[model samples]
Structure formats: structure tokens, C-alpha cells
Target chain A: MDYVLLIEQLLNGFQLGIILFLMAAGLTLVFGIMDLVNLAHGSLFMIGAFVGGTLTLVTDSLVLGAVLMVPAMFAIGVLVETIALRTLYRRSHLDQVLATFGLILFFNEATRLIWGPEGLAVPLPDFLEGTVALGAGITYPLYRVVIIVIGLLVALGLYLLVARTRFGMLVRAGASNREMAGALGVNIPVLFSLVFGIGAVLAGLAGLIITPITQAAIGMGEDVLILAFVVIVIGGIGSVRGAFVAALLTGIIDTMGRSFLDVVLLLFLPPNAAESAGPALSSMLIYILMAGILFFRPQGLFPPRGATAAP
Target chain B: MKSQLTPAHAVSALLIALCAAVPYLASALDEPFYVIVFARIMIWAIAAISLNLIMGFGGMISFGHAVYLGIGGYAVGILAFHDITSAWIQLPAAIGLCALVALVFGVICLRTRGIYFIMITLALAQMVFFLSVSAERYGSDDGLNILWRSDFGSGIVDLEDGAVMYYTIFAVLMGCLFLQWRMVVSRFGMVLRASQSNETRVQAVGIPTYRYRLAAFVIAGVMCGLAGFLQANLERFVSPDMMNWHRSGELILMTVLGGTATLFGPLVGAVVFLLLSEMLSTITIHWHLLFGPFLILVVLFARGGVMGLLGSRTTRD
Candidate 1:
């Protein structure tokens, strides 16, 4: 109930929101541009965390682990797109869902087989280890602050890449009108592979950055996949700016709800009932937010232009 | 209409008859496990059928259809706990509750199409899951155990008897299959299929396709509820895990793997999925390691599923 605790929780929420944005950006881009529903995006995140964790353990350097993960994830992304997903682009959404869902099953089991079911811990670097002091005796994890900073930088970079760059223009054109982009000799297939690779790298980057905070494990991507879906839905599909805002909003709302919901409920209900209801209600908070938003704007907060009714 | 059935129809009917007779034959031969496995497969078949109704017929890809199973199971569990084990009360309540929930959720979700629709349904189901986990009165995350199965009158029909329970499930499965077959050929089903093929055309033709789709969603939910009730009785337990998103994925897998849009597809899918799981688990602890790649192979090569593959070959010949 104190101001300092509230502020700390708010910061925690913001950090979570940033991470969700990172995950959602790639998903929205894939959906908007490719018109493909890739359920395996979460697997990309899982792979990133697993690979990054292993590399960090070997190299004993967070920076090097992250740097290596980008290219590694990019390669995997391109390979998957070329080998499996290319055929699915011409198929129905149901087929795409099944195929990608298969990829998820494959990736999860593969990771478990390789890394074991027990989660791997990614230790924070010495400089990012301790808590930084906030005003009024409050403290927060330095690593989390760095994540927020990095996430924002990525968000800004994405905005510039999509809105200002030539590649971004082609991507936008492809998203808005795929056949037209192709007709204009945009090399649609190669562009699609590039987009897929970028998305994979972003997902991997998010996984690597969040690994220090959360122990890397198989099936870790499942929950985050759902969260990223929520983020994209709330932000408006195919909009990075929207994903950033929605991710931050969801993260803060979800974190604050989890941290303070019990305290808030105590005012209306008895202590035991409040304790029991709090966790359940907190878990539902973001979903409720999503439902509310969709109720008002079925297309989401910032829907991409030329997006037709999805099949 | 002609009284004679087509050769294909006759063959399917014969197949169903053979399957029904297998349980009795197995029990008579002192192999009750086969009957038990068949019964389990039938229960999941019912669940898969429900998923196909939405995903295949209505063009709605719901990633959380397992929530209905959970709802149905919890209905039976909660009722049994309160000393109301009569089918007269429990069965209606289960279907009704699932339908009500589906109606409310579908009203909001059916507005959106494609990926957004998929994600929203998933998120809502997850919310339901979290709620189930939080409710301490219902055993929370640990789940609840049923003390007794749904009771019927003595002598005539006793669900406590395994043979009787197996027969009951088989009868229900047959009834569901028949109903689905009849539904798909009906006028309403035509509209539903039309929507699935081309919604814009259906809308342009002055059909308010959303309403039909919503109705289909409710019907599917109710059927899944029936499956859930049987599952609770069969296992003598109910838990949140029954309604997990993973279970939903499995339901979708069953539908696709068995040749969606076909009348017997869900049943075929369920039987294959369960049998495969049972066989693989017996062989190795890390069965999923093998099963995962198998799924990928199925998707990559077998786009038509088992039945579709069979149907195509037969047509060619």
C-alpha cells in the first residue's frame, strides 16, 4: 500500500511489458506480412534461451552469448521458412496451424531431449547483478532496468526500420499488398525469408535477455506465446509501435495486479478469501483487459492499413 | 429417397458394428483392458467431434475447446460432491453450462476472424484455467476425486459396472456420429459449410453467417460437455489439467490427423492418437521425443490425413 512499493511494482510491470512487446513484434509482423499464423514463434524464443544459456555457460559472457544468438536464430528462422513454412504459405490457415503446431511439439521435445527437462539458470553478469536504489528506500534489479533500456532501444530501432528505411517500406508494401509487391519485382520470396529471419532473431533476442531473470526451460515459450498473442491483439496486428505500447500496458497491468491485487481485495473480502482470490484474479487481469479492448475496437488499438478480415 | 444404402455407407456401418462388437468380444475373452482402452478412445472421440464441429464445419479455429471438457468434468465432480449423482440432473446441467459459456464467449470472439480469433479464444481459456486453479473450494490445482460414478436404477442400468459403462459410451458415440452426419447434410449444415469455404460470398448472399457460426459453436460446446461428463465418470476424477491448452491442442491434432470434415474423422483421430500414445509410452519414457517428429512428418507429407488419403486412393482406382 505504500507509495514506494507501488512504484517498484509499477517498474516491474513496465519491464514485463517491454519483454512482451519484443515477443509480439515478430509475431505481428509474420501474421501481417506473410498472412501466416506461425505457432512456432514461441519455439524460436525457447531455442534462443536454450542456445544463449548454453553459450553463456561456455563463454561466461552475456554479451557474447547474445551476439552469437542473433545469427544462430536468424539461420534457424531462414531454414525453417525455406524448408517447412514456404509450402504452407499457399495452404489454408488450418494447415498452417497444424504444421506450425507440429514445429512447436518438435522444438519442445527436442529441447527437452537435448537440455533435459530441468531448467537452466542464466546467471547475471557482475555489473548487472545487484539491485539499484530508487528513491524512498526502494530498490529494483539492475538487470531488469537494463532489459527495459534494451527493449526500448529495440522498439525505437524497429520503428525506424519499418517507417524510415527502404526495407521497411518494402515490408509495409508486402504486408498491405503482397501480390502488388511481387508484381513490382520486390523479390517476395527472398523478402519473406528475410522478414522471417528478422522476426526469429528478435524473438531469440528477447529470450536471451530475459534468461537471466527467468531460468530457461523447455515449454517456457508456451506461456510467453500466449502473452505475445495477447500483446499483438491488443496493440493491433502488424504495428510495432502498437505492440510497444500494448506490451508496456499489459506488463504493468499484469505485474501490478499480481503484486497488489491481494492487498486491494482485502478491503472488500476477508483475509483468507482475499489471499485465495488474488492470484486467480491477477492471472485473469490481462485477459480481461484484452477482452475489454476487443469489445470496443474489434480490430485492436492500432490496426495496420489494408488489413482485410482474417480467415 | 431410396431405402438401400450406398456401398461406402454400408462399409462404414459395418466398420462401426465391428468396433462395437470388439469390446464385448474382448471382455468375454478375459481382456478387459482392451475394452477399457476402447472406452477411453470413445470418450476422447466425443471431444474431438466437438472440436471438428467448430474447426472443420464452421470455419472457427478455437484453440481452447478443452475448456468445455473441463467444465463438463467439473460439473459432474461438483454435483457428485454435493450428493447429486443422478444422470437426470448432472447431464443436463453439464451441457447447459458449457453451452451458456460458449454462447457468451462466442458472441464476443466470433466477431473477429483468423489469428486474432485463435489468440483470443486461447487467452480466455487460460483465464478460465487460472480461475479453476485459484478456487480453493474445488481442490484448486490438485484437482478433485469422485467418490462414485453417476448412478442409475439397479438391474436395468448400473454405471458402476465397467461393461455397462463401456456400452453406454459406445452407444453415445454412435448417436453423436449419426447426429453429426444428419446435421452436415441438412440445410443449416450447408450454410455452415458455405461460410467456411467463402464467408464473403455467404455474407453477400444475405446470410448473417456469424449467427450460424455462433450456433455451431454452442452445439460443439454442448457435445464436448457430454464427453467431459463421461470422462469424469470413467476416470473417477476431475482436474484443471483436463482443460489445459495442451489438451486443446491435442483435440485439434486429433481432428486434423483423422481427416477433418469427414463424418468419422474425429473418431478415427481420437482412436489413433490414444493408441499411439499408449503404444509409445509403453516403449519408452521419452515417447514425445519420437512422437514430436512423427507429427511433423504427418503435417509435411500427409496433408489429407488418414481418411483423406484412403478416400483419394479409392477414387483414383
Candidate 2:
């Protein structure tokens, strides 16, 4: 009922949406272009968080850590693509799922081995520590506002790269028809690796930005990754625009549902019954939304034009 | 489908016999630990076999198959919480609930194909998982403990005894395998396999492949629910962890590790995967680091899994 609280939750949802977009963008692109299901994409996000977390700890500078995290994730992405995933693009989806599932295990355990099981945190720099006041006595964290700006900037940058550039044209072509793009002398393998690298970098950026808020921990990528999957699935798997819109939609729905479902349920049920059922129903909100979306539009709201649902 | 015994059939029979004999053999050797291990293996085998029905034979790669196992486990746990200990009631409830869940999921999911199908199933399973996690009446994330095993009502079977529980699982597993064998050779099975191999071609021939696939999914879900019932009886506990996405991945691994599309591949894969995990976990905490790469290698080099290594007929036919 309070407008201030409503605005605050909306901002919370927007911030979460921006973070999910970072993760989902890479996932959609890799899945769209390479036709591979990389379960370890979450592992890449975890690795970035760890790298970013560790770099910030040692150097005591957030900007340098941010600068290093992208390249580190990009390098690891290229390495994984060249070593394991390249051989799997032509394999069955089952094979891709299993192999990448294995990578998730390997990455999680490797992180535990290297960093120990204890979660590592990155402190907020001095300048970005304060909160900003909006109208109606509403206040929001400056760091979260920065995340929104950065996420939008990245989204715009990706849109320009994908829509305006020659390479973006090739990516579009590849997503629509891989064999045709390859036949057109696109150097398909390198293009695949580059796309993969970009995807990894994007995931890494999400991890780096959020580590200060969420803490860098082993297996953190997985929870976000599942949400990212929901975003892309509801958005249309191969569409970046879909991922962006779906991410924000999911984030808002999830945030608002969690915070307000109990109050809303109180209107329909007795107080005790509403109290007990609200949390469970709230947790299911996004999935129910996803199911409804899939039921109506099986290919998602914004399926990439000319690309078949499966590929 | 040939009724005559072949080399693969002989090998499968030998494996089943070996499984049935494990408790007896371990008793003679005075190692009760092996009984527990084999019991766990049999439970996992049942779940894996059900997964194979959908994945290998039906060509519907459901990534959330383990949710049935969780649903089954939770059915018994919830019933026991409210003082219903009879196997007749608890088991039926588990299977029925699993069937209903599968029907709902299959209806929505079968509308999509390939990766979309996989993601939708995963999302739906996660939905149930979150629900379980929020259910404060149950133990939620900590899981619930059943005070007593399913009461068979003065029958010769007493699950309180480890051997009885083990044999009960063994009998159910064998029954499932038999059912699977029968289904795979039946007219319906042929339609399911054909649909998996080529959906358009089958549809062009006038078969409603979606219905067959959905039926296969439901059957597999119910079978997995049975496994969940036995698992709760074995451990006396049920948690959302049982149906976590990782567990679903493990089911897929077991099917692939054994060699998909083969009759006993899931059984074989479950044995190898569980045994390897048990052995590796003792060495260090980083066993998954080793196991992960090994899984990748298996996918890369050992494409057909353990049964494929034996080079027998890959499919049930």
C-alpha cells in the first residue's frame, strides 16, 4: 500500500533483472549461435566472481578488478571452448548436457580446492557506499543504481555489436542457419569461439558486479544460472532482446511476489492459512509465469526471427 | 523382439542374479556394509531404469526425472507424518501423486521439442523443489524422517530387517526391468521408439507421437516414484535434496554411463557410478574434481558407456 515501499521493491527487481540479463545474454548467444547447452556457463560466472573477488582483495582496487575479470573469463571461455566444447557442437544435446554438467562439478570442486570452502567477499569502495534519496522518502543504494546503468550500457553495447557490425551480421546468419553461414566463408569455428568468449565475459561481468553484494562463493553461479535459463526460455532462447525483457520481468515478478504475496493472500484466505501458504506460492510465481508463457507461446515471447525453436 | 536367450540377455540375467545374491554373499562374508551399498545401488537403479524408459527408448530427454523420486519419497514421509504407515496406502499415494505430477508436466512439456522440452521440465521440477523448501509443515530443506517403515500388515516381508528391505528393492527392480522389457517389445513401445527416432515421420504415418511420449513420461514418472518410496523406506528420510537438479543429472549420467537405449544399461551404469563415487569420496574431498573430468572423458571417448564398451546390441530390439 505504501508507494515508497513499492518503488523500493521495483528498484530491487530492476537491479536483480540487470544482473540476470548479464548472465542470460551470454547463455542465449552461446545457445543460439553454437547450438550447445553449456551447463557450465554458471561455472564460468563462479570463476569470474572468484577471480574478481581475489583480484580486488590483493590489489585493493575495484576498477582494476573489473578490468581483469572480463579478460580472465574470456580467456577461460576460449580455453574451454577450444578444449572441450568445440568437439561437442555436433554432438547430441544429451552429450552436451552431461559433459557440461560434469564441468560444473569440476569447477565447483576446483574452486573449493583453490579458495577453500569459505565464501570470499569484496568490500564496497568508499565513494559508492552511500544511498541516494528519491522522491516520496524513498532511498536506494548507489551501488545497485550503478549496476542498472552498467547493465543497460552493456545491453546497448551488445545490441549495437549484434545489429550494426559485420560480425554481428555473421552471428545473426549463424543463428539462423549454421551450415549456410559456414558456406558463406564465415570462419565458423573462430566465430563460434568469439561468440563463446563474449558470452563468458558477459557472465563474468555479472559475477564481478554482484560479488560485492552477494559475496563470491562456490556454486553461486548455479542459482543465478537456473533463473537465467528461465529468463531465456520465457524470452525465447536465441534472442538477446528476449533475454533482457524476460530477465527484468522475472526479477520483478520474483521480487514482488516474495515481498507481497502474503499480504495479497490475506485477502483470500484466513490469516493463519495465508501466512503458511504465501511463501510456497510466492516461490512458485516465476515458474507459474513461465509455464503460462510456454503454454501460449512455446517458442517464447520473442524467439529470434528465422531461427527454428530447436537449433 | 526375440524370446530366445542371447548373450546380452545372459549377461543381464547374470547381473540381476548377482544383485539378488549380494546380501546373501555379504552375510556369508560377514560384511553388512556391502548390503547397505547394494541396497542404495538397487534404489538408484530403479530410478535410472525409469529415466532410461523416457530418455533412451522414448527419446524424451527429461532433465527433471529425479523430481518423481522426490515426490515418491515425500508422499511416504508426509503420510507417515500423519500416521499412515501401511505400504498399501503409502505406496499407492506415492505412485498416484507422481503420476498426476507427470501428467501435468508431460502435457505442458510435450508441447515443446528438444532443448525447450529439457528446460521446461527442469523449470517445473524446480517449482516443486521450491514448494518443498517452503513447506514449513514438513521438515522443508532439512527433510522429514519417517518413524517406521511401511507396514505390510503381518506379511512375511519385514522391512525392519536390512535383508528384507534389500530383497524388496531387488524384487521391485526386477519387476520394473521385466515391465520395461515387455513395454519395449510391445506395439506401443515400437510407436514410442519410432517417434523418438523420427517424430515427423511417425506423425506423417498418422501416429499421435506426443500422446505416446506423454504416456512414456507418465509411466517413467510412476516407476521412479516407486523407487522414491523404497528410498525413503531405506533411509527413513525424505528431503527436497532427493529431487534436486544435480540428482536428475546423475540419473542421466547413469543411463549414459551404462549405454542408453539398452535394456540393462541403466542398471549397469548405476552400479558403476555409485561404486565410483563411494570409492572416490574416501580419497579426498575433491573427488568431484576428478569425477567431473572423468564424466567429460566418458562423453568424449566412451560414447556408448560401459555396455557400449561390451559391444552388444545397443537398443532393446
Candidate 3:
């Protein structure tokens, strides 16, 4: 119930939201442009974390690791798309779900085989290690602040890429009508691979940045992947702007719910009962939020152009 | 009428007889493990059959069918925790709770389709999973254990006995298979299958297909719940992991693996899935590594599933 502690928790929530945006943005784009349900998206995030974590360990430099891993992940993304995912574009969603679910099992086991079952942590650079004073003797981790900044920059870059570039226009056109775009000579297959690769890079970047705070572990991407799905559903699938706003909202709501829900519940019930029930209820808050949103706005907050209406 | 039994029907009759004789054979061999494995397979086969009700005929494609299993399992576990060891009360409660959850979730999820339907169902089940994980009163994430199986007294039946449990499951499976066959051939099943084949055309034909699909979803949910109830008693334990997304995937896999759109497809798929797991685990600890690629191969090559492969020459045909 400390006021400062509550504010700190809110900031933590914002940071988490920013990270979720990074993951969700790429997912929304892939789904929007290519009309592909990529369950292997989470695998890309895990791969990024693993690749970044390994590079950081070898180089002993976070900056170098970050720089090198981005392109490395993009290449991996392109390779996966060309080899495995490209063929799936013309298939049904059931096939996509089954194949991607298989990929999850594959990636999880592969990670375990390579990295062992234990989680590995990346050392925060010395310059970014200290806490920043936030007045009244309260301090927050500077590294987290950096993550937020980087996430914001990426979000901005994404907006420009989607809104300004010629490729962005083609993406928008493809999302609206794939056949029409293909008829217009958009090189649809290559375009899908490019969009997928970009999505992979974005997910990988989010994984890399978050690695310093959280451990690099097998199956780390699943939780985040689900959250990203929730964000897209609430934001309106295929809408990047919707993803941004929804991700931030989900992050703040989820973090705040977890941190203060128990204290808030104690007002209505006995302390012991509240303590036990609060966490359980709080964990479900975002899903409830998602349901509520879907109930009111079945197509989401920002329905993408040319997107088919939901049943 | 006697010659009406075709070769396929004769084979099916022979298979049923062999299945009926399994317990006696196992008992004669004194291999309780084989009986137990068969019993386990029957239990899951029932669950998979329930999943197929929605996925195949209803075309709902719910990814959270296992939630009913967890609900059914937890119903038994919770009742046992409160020292209510009666099957009469536990079974109804399990089915009722699962029906209630499905009612609510179906109301919301049936409003969407395709990817949204898949994601929403997954999220709702995850909500249930997180709730179970955080429930300190119900042993939280570790799950709750049953102290004793439901008993019906000396004159009738004792479920505590393994062979009795096995026969009970077999009877339930047979009953469910019969119900599924009846339901699929009924007028309602025609509507559901029509919707799956062509929603626009079904609508053009002046049928309100959404209601039919929703009804099918509820029925499937309730059936899955029954399976969950049986599974809880069979395992004598319940955990959040029972309702996890991975289990949902496995349920779908069972349906698809055995050949979707077929009456006993899920049963066959579940048996194959469990047998594969048992065999693979014995060979290597990282069995999922093999299972994952196998699923991909099934999707890529065996689109019609095992039953489809055996019954049909091509997926589209």
C-alpha cells in the first residue's frame, strides 16, 4: 500500500507493456499481410534469446551481441520461411496449426538439447547496471528504462515502415486483398517471405533486449506468445496501431493487477483468504479484459482494412 | 439379413470381440500392466471421441477441450477433499461444471471463427489453468490426489478394482461411440456437417447454421466433460496441466491423427498416441523431439489421418 511502491509497480507494468508491443507488433503484421497463422512465431523469439544469450556470453559485450544477433536472426527468419513456412501459405489453417504446434515441440526439445534444461542469464552492461533516482529516495533499474526506450524506437520505426515505405503499401494492399495484390504483380510469395522474416527479426529483437532481465530458457516464449495473441485479439488482428495501444494497456493492467490486487482484495475479505484468492484472480485479469473487449467490439478496437468480419 | 454382414463389418465385429476378450486374456497372463494400459487407452479414447464431436462433425475446432477434462478431474478431487466419495454426486457435478464453462465460453467464442476462435478458446483455458495454478486451497499447481475411487457396494460393482474400472471404461466408450454414431446420422448432424462444408451455401439454403454450430459446441463440451470426469477417477488425480494448451493440441492431434470426420477416429488416434508415447519414452527421454516431427509429417503427408489413409485413397477425394 505504499504510494511510491505502487508508482514503481505501474512503471514496471509500462515496461512490460512496451516489451509485449515489440512481440505483438510483428505477429499482427505477419497475420495481417500474409494471412498466415504462424505458431512458430514463438520459436523465433526463443531462438533470438538463445542466439543473443550465446553471443553475449562469447563476446562479453552486450552491445556487440545485440548488433550481431539482429541480422543473424533475420537470416534465420528468412531461411525458416523459405524452407518450411512458404509452402504452408496456400494450405488451410488446420494444417498451419498442426505444423506450427509441431515446430513448438521441435524448438523446445532442440533448445533443451543445446542449452540444457537450466536457464541462462545475460550480464547487464556496467554502464546500464545502476538504478535511476525517481525522487523521494525511490529508484528503478536503468536497464529497464533503456528497454522501454529501445522498444519505443522500434515501435516508431515499425510505424514508419508500415506507413511510409513502398513495401509498406504493398503489405497493406496484400493484407486487404491477397489475390488482387498478386494480380497487380506484387511478387506475393517473396513478399510473404519478406514480411515473415521481418516479423521474425522483430520478435528476435524483443527476445534479445528482454534477455538481460529474464533468463534465456526453453519455453520462455510460450507465455509471451499467448499474451501477444491476447493483445492482437483486443487490438484487432492485422492492425499495428491497435497492437501498440493494446499491448501497452495489457502490460500495465496485468502488472498492476498482479502487484496490487492482493492488497485491494484484503479490503473485502480476510487477509489470509484475500492473499490466496488475489493472485489467482489477478492472473486472469487480462484474459477477462480480452473477453470483455471482444464482447463489446468483436472485430477489436481497430479493425484492419479489408479484414473479414468475425462470425 | 445374416449375409448383410460385409467383410468390413465382420472385421469390425472381430475387433470388438478381441477387445472384449482383452481383460480375460490379461488376467490369464497375469499381466495387470497390459490391462491398465488398455484401460488408460479406453479412457483417453472416450475423451478424444468427445473432442471429435465438435472438431469433426460440429466444425467448431475448439483448442481447449481438455479444460473439461480438468474440470471433471477437479470435481472429483475437490469432492474427495471435502470427503464426499460418492460417484453419483461427483459425476453429475463434473459434467455440470464442464457444461457451465462450455456454455459461457461457447457463448463468447462462437461469436468468432477461424483464428479468433482458436485463440479465444486457448486463452479461456489458460485462464482456467492459471486459476488452478494459483489456487492454494486446491494444492495449487502441483494438483490434488484422490484418496479412493467411488464405490457402489458388494452386490453390484467396485470401481476400486482395476479390472472393474477397465470394464466400466470400455462400456462407457462403447456407449459414447453408439451415441456419436446416432448423433452424426441424425438431422442435426446433417446441418452441422453442411455448415462445415459450406457456410455460405448453408446460409443461402435458409438455415441459421450458427445456432446449430453452437449447439454442437455445447454438446461436444459436455461430452468432453464426461470424459474428464472418467479420466479423473481413472488417474485418481487432477492438475492444471490436464487443461493446458499442450493437452488441447494433443486432443486435436488424436482426432486428426486417427482420421477426423470418422466415428472412431479419435479412439484410434488416442490409442496410437498413447502407445507411441509409451514406446518413445522407453526409447528416449526427449520423445517429443520425435513426436513433433511426426505431427508435421501427418499434417504434410497424411492429411486425412490414419483412418483416412486406410479408408480413402486421397485427402481431397
Q: Against the hidden reference, what TM-scores do the models get?
A: 0.94, 0.98, 0.95
- How well does candidate 2 score on lDDT at residue B109? 93
RMSD vs true structure, all candidates:
2.7, 1.3, 2.5
Off by over 4 Å in 1: A269-273, A309-311, B1-11, B153-155, B312-317
For each candidate in turn, the interface RMSD (Å) is 1.8, 1.1, 1.4
Each model's total of backbone clashes: 0, 0, 0
Q: Report the candidate with higher DockQ, 2 versus 3.
A: 2
How does model 3 score by TM-score? 0.95
Docking class of 3: medium
Candidate No. with top DockQ: 2
User: Which candidate number would show the highest lDDT if scored against the true structure?
Assistant: 2
**Worst lDDT 10-window in candidate 1 chain B:** B308-317
Model 2 chain A scores worst on lDDT over the 10 consecutive residues at A302-311
For model 2, the docking class works out as: high
State the lDDT at A145 in candidate 3: 83
Task: Using TM-score, give the best candidate's number.
Answer: 2
